[model samples]
Target: MKQPLLTTDFLDRAVDLFADDVGIVAEDGTEYTYGEVGDRVNRLSNALRERGVEKGDRVALLSKNSHYFIETLYATTQLGALFVPLNFRLQPEEYDYLVGDSDPDVFITDAEHAGTVTHLQDEGGVDEWICYDADDAEAGQWDDYEAVLEAASPDQPERPDISEDDDATILYTSGTTGDPKGVVHTHRTQHYHAMVHAHHVEFEDDDVLLWTSPMFHINGWGHIYGLTGIGGKHVIVRDFDPQTVFERIVEHDVSFLGGAPTVLNFLLEHNEEHDVETTGANPVRVETAASPPPKRTIRRTEDELGWRIIHAYGATETGPLITTSNSPRRIQDGDKYDIVNKPGFATINTEVRVVDEDGNDVPCDDETKGEVIARGNQILDRYWNKPEATEEAFTDRVEGWFHTGDIATMDANKMLTIVDRKKDVIISGGENISSIEVQDVLYDHPDVRLAAVIGVPHEKWGETPKALVVPHDGADLTEEEIIEFTRDRLAHYKCPTSVEFREDLPQTSTGKIQKFELREDYWNDDEDRRVN
Candidate 1:
C-alpha cells in the first residue's frame, strides 16, 4: 500500500487531474468536463449549506444513474453531510422504514420518483426534498434542483476538519432480521477501498465507465470514487435496458461497467434488432457481484459480446469490492472456458481464509469447504444506531476479522468457489437459492405455525422461492392463498412461488431448520458450484 496522499477533497483533486477529459455524458447526449463537474459540485454544496444542510447531516438521494446523482453525492460530501443513497427498486414502505430510521436532512430525487417522495413527505416528519427535474409538471411540489445550483456559489468551501473515523456515507443493507441496517463508512475507509480497486482492477484515466448498475448499490461497487480517483470518464444511464446498454457501450466507447448476474443475463438474452459490433477485442469490461454469474453467462459474454467479464464479491458492509475473478491469461492457449469459470483469488487489500466452525483455517485443497472470512481496510465502521449489532459484527476470537458468513473453498492455487450462504440455499433454474431473506417474510405471516422456504428450479427468474408450511393444528391452507398472502405482504422477489404442505420440518438437535437437508433433493443434479 502506498503512503496516503490527500485526506479530503478527492473529487476536487480528480477534477484538476482530469480537467480536459470528459467527466460525464448523459444518455440524452449532454456532456461535461471534470473541471465543470467540480465547479458544479462545489456550487451544489454551497447551495445545500444555505438550505440548512450542515456538517454530518444526512442527505438522501433517490434517483437513477445520471449526472445529477453524481453531483448530489459529491456536493453532499463537500458540506461534510453523509450521502444516503436510496434504492429506487425498494418498495415505498421499505423506503418509509429507512427514512424513519435515518432521518436525512434532504432527499435529492428526480421527477420519476417525485410522487413516491411526496407520499413519504406527506406521511410527514421528513425534513425536505429537492427534485432534479422539477420544472416538469409531473414533479408537483418539490423545489427545482437546477434553480438551486444556479443561485449558489461555485467557490469550494474550506475542507471541513474531518477525522478518518468520521462517517461519510450510510449505505443500507437488508437484514434477515428486520427492515435494513445502515452500514456506515468513513472517508479514509472509502478511499482505501477505491485505492484497492484502482490498483487491482486497473481502471485507467482514459477508460469510459458505463453506469449499468444502480448508483444506490454500494455506490455502484465503489466506482463513484474508484473510477473518479483515476480520472475515468462516466457515461450515465437513466435506466438499464439491453438496447440502451449496447448503444451506450458503443456510443461512448465504454471500457468499464459493473452489474449483477441479472444484468448480464438480460444482455445475453436480448434479441433486439440493433446491429451490435462485438468482434475483435471488446472495449467493454464488466464486474459482476449481485449474484454469481453462471458458467453459460460467463462464456457467452466472452465468446459473443467480446466482453471480459470479471466476478467480484463483496457486501455493502465491506465497501463492496473485496475479491475479483481475474480471467487467467493462460486461458487463451487452451481450455479458455475452464479458466474463466473459477472465481479468482482474494483482492489486493483483502486477506481471506476459509474456516471451519471451530475457527481454524481450512486447507487450500479446493475440495474442503468452509466459511469465508476477511479482514480489510474497507470494512464498515459500524451499523448505525445499533451498538449491539456493531459489537457483534466486529466480534470474533480472531482479531480484526469480519465473518462473511459465505461458505467457500480454495484451490491449491488460491482460487475460491463460493458454495452457499451458511443458512439458506434455494434451487431454481438449476441454481441454489439462498433464502437468507425469505425466512424473514415467512416468519412474519400470521397463520403460519412453522414456515421453511426453499427454492425449486424455475425456467425464468433463475430461482423462485418455494415454502414448506406446517399450518396450525387441523388447518387447511392452499398454496395459492399462501402465495397471494405473501405477494401482498412482501417484495415480489421474496414471495414464495410454490408451497408444500408438511406435518413437520427437518430440524437439528438445537432446533435450527436444516435447510441443507431440505434443498438436497431439488439440487441433486445441478452442476453449478452453489448447489453443492
Candidate 2:
C-alpha cells in the first residue's frame, strides 16, 4: 500500500496538530499561535466567501511578509480560489499592469500601501480593496480587513476537492521581451515539489523554518505547506536585516532559512564586520536560489559565520524547488568554488538536460554548454488565460522538454553549472560577454554590496556592458573606480564602460535584480531597442 499524497488540505491539519504551539513571531515581536493562525485563516476565508469569492476566483494579495500574508494565502487555498500574490516592491504603474492582467476579484493590501491600491482602483475596474488596518487610515473607500473579520464567520467549510491538475497559483514572470507572463501551477505539482524539497534538503518535522523570503515566492518554496505537513514550526519576518535575522535565528532557535544570493551576501558581509553567533547547538542552514552564489562569499559564510549555505534552482513556473544541492558529501567534501557556482542536480523525479538550440541533448562532458531544460512533476500546468504562451513554454519543439532559456553545463558526476541566461548575454564587438561573469567580478570588490550588468548602446562595439552598483554603506565610489575594479579581472570589452550609483538597487520580490527595469532606462528613447 502507498501513502496518501500531501495537499493544501494538510495546511489546516497542521494547525490542529500543532495547536497551542507558537506559529509565527512577527517583526514587531507579536506572536501568533497555531490556534490563532487557524482562526484567522478561517475568518479570512469566511470573509472572502461573503464577498462571493467562489471556487477558481482569483483573489490577489499585495503585502509584505507578515502573519496576515500567510493567512490570506491559506485562506484563499481553502476555498479553492487562486492565490495571486503581487510583488510588494513593484511600483504603482507596474502594479496597474499586473492588476489589469490578473483581474482579481478582491485586492487585499496593507494600510501603508492603501494609497497605491486606491490609485489603482481609481483608474477603474477592480472589485474591492481589503486593507490590513483601516481604522485610522487615509485611503478612503476600502473594507477594513479586521473590521470585516470581526463579524465574519470562523467556521471553515470543508476543504474543496481540487483535482491534482486543477490550477493552484498563477505567478507572473518578467521576460526579456514584452510584458510578464503568468505561470500557472497545480496542487499535484506543488505537493510533489514539497516532497522533493524534503528529500533534497532534509526538512524534518522538528525543524523551525524561517520566512526570510517572501511568501509570494513559490509559496516560500512550498515550505508553507511542506513544513506544515510535517508539523514543523514556521517563523515569520517582515523584512531582512543582518541583526534582525541573527536575533531571530537565536531567539526561535531556527533550523532553516531561505533566500537569494543577495540576502546571503548581505548576511555574510554584515557578519564579517560585526560579531554574530547562533545560540542554538547546531548551526542553521541557509538555502539560496535565483542566481548562483559567489565562491568567495560562500566560503566566508561557512568559515566566518559558521552557517551552511546550499543552492536550489527553479523558476516561478516550476514551483521554485525542483533541484537542490543537499547530499551530505556534497556539503562536506565538494569544493566551495564549484558547489557555490553550480545549479546542482535535479531533485528526485526531476529530469534535467542541457540541449542545443536544435533541441538535441548536449554531451555532459563539462565543456559543452547548452540551454538548460527540465521536465518533472513540479512543472507548471499552464499560463492562465494565455494559451499561446503556455504552449511555447511547455514545448521547446526539439525534445518536448520545458526550455528554461538558461545556458548551462554538467560534469560527468552530474553537478550542473550555469553558463548564463540565454537572453542576457552581452554580444559586443562580435564577442559574447556573460553578464553574470562581469557582475561576479564587481561583487568581488570589498566596497560593492550589490551589482548588476546589462548591455548599453555603443556605436563602436555595437553594444557595451553597463554596470549598476550599490556601494557598501558609507563607502565612497566613482565610475572610474568601478571600471578600474573590473578591468583587471575581466576582458576589456566585458568591463563596464559606464557605472551608475544607487542608494539601493531595484529587486524583485525574490531578491533578483530587476535587470529588465535597469535595461528600460537605457532603451527608453529607441523604438527598436535591443540590448545586444
In order, candidate lDDTs are 0.73, 0.79
Best TM-score among the predictions, by candidate number: 2
lDDT of 2 by residue, 190-303 (tens): 888887787677777788887889887777888877777777777788877888888888888888988788988888777777878754655688888988777766777777
lDDT of 1 by residue, 194-302 (tens): 8887776678888888888878777777788878767888889877788878777776778888766546655765632354664323377777675555566677677
| lDDT for residue 258 in candidate 2, whole number 0-100 | 87
Best lDDT among the predictions, by candidate number: 2
Cα error, candidate 2, residue 115 (Å) = 1.2
Candidate 2 residues lying further than 4 Å off, grouped into runs, are: 1-6, 120-126, 278-281, 331-333, 397-399, 473-503, 524-532
